[model samples]
Target: MNGNTERQFATNVYYDRTFDCDAAKILPGEFYYTGQDMLIVTVLGSCVAACIRDRVTGLGGMNHFMLPDGGDPASPVSASMRYGTFAMEVLINELLKAGARRENLEAKVFGGGAVLRGFTAMNVGERNAAFVMNYLKTEQIRVVAEDLNDIYPRKVYFFPRTGKVLVKKLMQTQNDTVAKRELDYASRLKVEPVAGEIDLF
Candidate 1:
């Protein structure tokens, strides 16, 4: 048996509670799921994850983030979700809080695309992909599936209760997304305030 398959699991549910996953935005590392409910989610960029589940309890959560903080003492748990450092922490904590044990967790990963223009070959997508793979490797979490590292954006739906995901590839491979991102970045750039001079009469 493969090392991963030997460690994988499937959780079954007897009853489910429905939760409305509306347009409400979820930040990085923030996992959302009802105990027995199926969830549909969406994201529009490059990121990577370890989607962990408990087979016996039918509980699970996914960790999707970019940078790894390497267990820094100063690491903010909230910020770690945005970065790789605390993403695993947040996911594990969320799942544990929901009553899943560490041994029962399995994973599926997605995202990490380089769809924008002019980022050379190795960019955030590549970095994110690498970090996720390395993190999963170190953690020994079994990856059930992975869809990553292309020149297109994807929309993802994660069913936490069932550990199933549906992905849709978006086909805007031009500079449109780049232009929009650049515009937004430019808008956020700070300019120094001009010092006021006394007006001469």
Candidate 2:
């Protein structure tokens, strides 16, 4: 079936199911499922997730991106949606391709928190939040809701059928952040993420 049909099926079949923690199985950075009533979800940290929905039809899809750069030669499509610039383009394009009118498209963004310690919470969240909002404005897309710029992490839920997004501010005290920082530092030092063609951040 096409993406449109899949959306319809998702709306009709699983609208009332639980989508917490390991709910809908969206591939890394990319995910799609019939939510006829099910809540599709994805987790994020330094990354940002965009929830796009058709204003009229209510069909929607959410993508999680790690950096602003997707299509990074080193970052395959599997993880590219986790990037900022590419993720925005890809989600928007996919929405249009699925029969969503650009004029009728609504976007909701979440994440980009500096969850890791030692990292200047100096606003990576602000920058990512700004990047997505600015892109939406430039593209003429309407931003229906935005829960951003907080020091704490968030858990967001996107209801495709009605296009309602639920945001929960997860209180991650210093203790929570410090642990994440150590792990992030080790990964960052080990895996040097290559830059993509365009630096969207």
| Candidate whose TM-score is highest | 2
lDDT of each: 0.53, 0.57
Q: Per-residue lDDT tens digits of candidate 2, residues 121-180?
A: 344455567667776787777887877666667767777878877777777753365335
lDDT of 1 at 158: 68
Which candidate number would show the highest lDDT if scored against the true structure?
A: 2
Residue 52 of candidate 2: its Cα lDDT?
A: 82
Estimate, for each residue in 97-130, the C-alpha lDDT of model 1 and write its tens digit: 6788767777777777775445434455666676
Which residue segments of model 2 deviate by more than 4 Å? Answer: 1-28, 33-35, 68-82, 120-122, 173-201
Off by over 4 Å in 1: 1-29, 68-82, 119-121, 173-201
TM-score of each: 0.64, 0.66
* Cα RMSD, model 1: 14.4
On the 0 to 100 scale, the lDDT of residue 81 in model 1 is 25
